[model samples]
Structures are given as structure tokens and as C-alpha cells.
Target: MTAAVVTGLGVTAPNGLGTEEFWKATLAGESGLGPVTRFDAAQYPSRIAGEVTGYAAEEHIPSRLMPQTDHMTRLALTAADWALADAGIDTGELPEYGIGVVTSASGGAVEFGQRELQNLWSKGKEYVSAYQSFAWFYAVNTGQISIRHKLRGPSGVLLTEQAGGIDAIGHARRHIRKGFPAVIAGGVDAAICPWGWVPQIASGLMSTVDDPARAYLPFAAEASGYVPGEGGAILLLEDAESAAGRGAEHIYGEIAGYAAT
Candidate 1:
């Protein structure tokens, strides 16, 4: 029996911008939690969040495209580029039917949402950048990733709350098994800012602790609910035959098998 292989990995998490950074922080048991920066906390009940700090869009995003791409989409695209490069696939002319993208994400263009609302209330409709038309949409990450890579093959997004993280891996593995050759697979959730919390604030699933340590603690004795977070990751998935033929390193593991309810 053949196994699906991992050829590339990219991650943007509350810990850091890429897999290296994420790994360093994780190994040291670093806490990424903090007060939200995109807005003032004078009014919101939940002021603290797990914010990804020191990440500059310019460092990860191409200057020309940044003006048009939303923050969430930018993270996804940047991660995708790194993943594809790590896979050693020149996406400039990808195999027509072998490349695909399967990603999971929650709220997108959320920062955009928070800002656009301000524009509407303080400025005018024309003041809204056209990117607002779809920046925060769930499908934007998958769409932008596919477009950047010219995947031209089957592409999809998983919106199953936090379940999306593993769902994306399953999607890519299934696609590879079906003989798709290669697929970019992962999940991203970049909704930790202002508007990201509106629904949660209303739904009462958010934290109320002013101390970052006490806020959004999961699985602890003082466990509250989750903190809204924003970040992205992409892992390159390929058929076993392809990766063994090329010989890549840092192969984390395989898409062995996953279980769900």
C-alpha cells in the first residue's frame, strides 16, 4: 500500500509567521496571548486574545499586491507560495489537473470588516476599498491560493469551525489518492481582531478576563472558551511516487488516517 507524503510545510500561527517560527515558539511553550491591538478595549467585554505579533505584511506579502489583498488572504497566499516553493513545484506552469488547494478557515477579511464598518459610519460607501467586496469571505483564501498557483484543478474550503484544521488534510489526502498528483492543503483562521469578536461577543462564547493569562485559556483548570485568533498555514501534499522521486527533506509525517465524528 502506498502512503501520501508531505513535501512542503508553511504555517502562520499565534506563535509565529512560518513553520520555523511556530516551531520555535511551540518548543519553548511560548504563550501568544495578549490584548487585541486593532482596536481600543474601552468597551468590549473580551479585551484579550491570542494575537500573532511582529508579523509584517510587507515581509510576507508582495508590496504591489498588499494594497488589494485582505490580511487573511495575504497570509494564505504568502504561506501557499512558501509551500509550493518548498514542494519544488514551479507553479508558473503547473500540471493542468494535478494541482489543487484544500484549506480550512473561519472568519476572513475580519480586519477588513472592522475597518470597513468604520468607513461606512464615518466616511461613505465610496470610501470602502473594493477589496471589501470579498476580503472577509470564507472562500477567499482558497480562491487566492488557487489563483496564485494556477492550480486549475479541484479546489475547496472547509468551514467546520475548528474542525476545519484536520478536514483540510483529509481533503488533500483524498485528492492525492484519487490521482490528483499534488495538492496544497491546510487551514487558516485570521479573525482575532475587532469584528472577529462581534458574533462571539453576542453569542457569549468569548472570554472576559482582563489578564491575558486568564483570558481564553483552553483545557486549563481556569479554562474559559477559546480566544479568537488570526493566522494561516499551508502544507504541500503529493502522491508518494512523486516525492520519493524528487527526494525532499523535513518530511514531518504522512496523511496516515484521520478519524472524526
Candidate 2:
């Protein structure tokens, strides 16, 4: 049997971008819930969201792939980049075939899909980007991360709605146990746009409260529903032996066990 340990963590949350910053905020009991600014939520029933602030994709994403990816993909890419740095695994020095990527996405790329549809109707089919067909898929993150970092092990994507992120980590552990040196696994999503929100609203699981502070209350008597938000997390899972062989220090934690129904 092989041991799978978590060596790196990357996050893009409504409260923070990096691990340390996010930790501090969490410790302080900070709340990221506020008015939705990504678009006008005034006309919608739910007008608040836990949105990531101060995120500039151009600073984190490669310029070449900027126009080709949606905000969800860019967030995943940024998280992956930071996760690699956190693990001290330089992609250039690692064996191309030793690493892999696995991610989960519930919403796919609603923002990109919405834009493409608008383009087709407002302008023409030619005005729509060729990247939309692939970029809007749920598996785009896994594919993009694998290509950008040259990881060639076993790559895949999981779509289990809210539980998908946790499931991805479990699958990555399975990959490591099966002989892969390491795996990048996690989930991301951004469906706060009009079209995206409509479908989510139809689910009837979202809150319609006008006050951001009192909107999302889980397991509480005041619990109405959830406030939609954008952002996700990424983690680097490596074999314990491989991590020790490379003298990789600063391990955060370990996924000692995992299972799914």
C-alpha cells in the first residue's frame, strides 16, 4: 500500500487569495459576504455573494491563454500555479510524465458559454471564439493545467456538484497509490452571471435575502439558503516516499484516509 499526503495548497476564496492570508481571515472570523458586483443583482431575488476581490487574472494567468479562458478557468490556473510554488515542485525540473491533474467543476464555464451565446445572436457565429467549445467544458481545468505544466500522468475531471471538490482529492490519492508520483487535484466554479444564476435559481437552493449578513445560514433556524459565490481551491498530492526522496519540506498535512459513496 502507498501513502498519499497533501504537500501543497492553493486557494482563491472570497476573503483571500493565498493560504496565509486566507488563514488569517478565517481566524479573525471575517465574512466575505457582500453585495454582488460582478453583475447587477438588483433585479434578482438573491443580491449577495461571497465574491473574490482584487483578483486580476492578467497578473496570474499567462497572457496567451487569457482570452481563451473564462474567469473560472483562470481562477483554477492561478490556484494551480500557487499550489506548485507552495509544494516547491518546479514543473520544468520534474519528469513530464510523473505528474497529473484532476479537478472538479460543478458549473462548468457558464460565464464563457453565456458570452458565446450572446455573440452568436448579437454579432454572428464568426464573432464567437473557437475556444468556447472546449473552454466551457467541466474538464477544461484539468486539461489546461496538465498542458500548461506538462503533466502527463493520469488526468481527469469530476462533476458532483457541491461535493465534487472533496471527491477530486480522493481520486488524486488513488492515483498516487497506483504509482503516479504526484497529482494536482481540486475544484473551481463561477456561475454568478445572469444565465448561470437563472439555472441556479431554478434549483431553489439559493437564498433570496437582501441582507448579505443574514442571507446564508446553514443548519440554523434562520437558514434560508445559500449565497452563490465564485472561486475554488487546488492542492498538490504526492507520494510520501517521493516527497521524502526530494527532501520536500513544509508539508502542510496528509490525507491519511478517504472514501466516497
Q: Each candidate's TM vs. the true structure? A: 0.91, 0.97
Q: Name the TM-score of candidate 2.
A: 0.97
Candidate 2 colliding pairs? none
Please give the lDDT score at residue 220 for candidate 1. 86
Model 1 regions more than 4 Å off = 92-94
Report the number of clashing residue pairs per model.
2, 0
**lDDT by residue (tens digit), candidate 1, 88-192:** 766554468778888888766777777887898899888888877777688888888887667887799888887897889888888888877788988877776
Q: What clash pairs does model 1 have? A: 108-136, 190-230
Query: lDDT for model 1, on a 0 to 1 scale?
Result: 0.79
Residue-level lDDT tens digits of model 2 in 1-261: 888888888999998888888889999988888998888988888788888899999899889999889999999999999999999987666676889899999878889999999999999999999998798898999999998988898999999988899999999999999998899999999887998888878889999988877898897999999888788899999999988888786777888898888
Q: Please list the residue runs of candidate 2 whose C-alpha ends up more than 4 Å from where it truly belongs after superposition.
A: none
Candidate 2, run of 10 with poorest lDDT: 89-98
lDDT values of the candidates?
Answer: 0.79, 0.89
lDDT of 1 at 54: 76
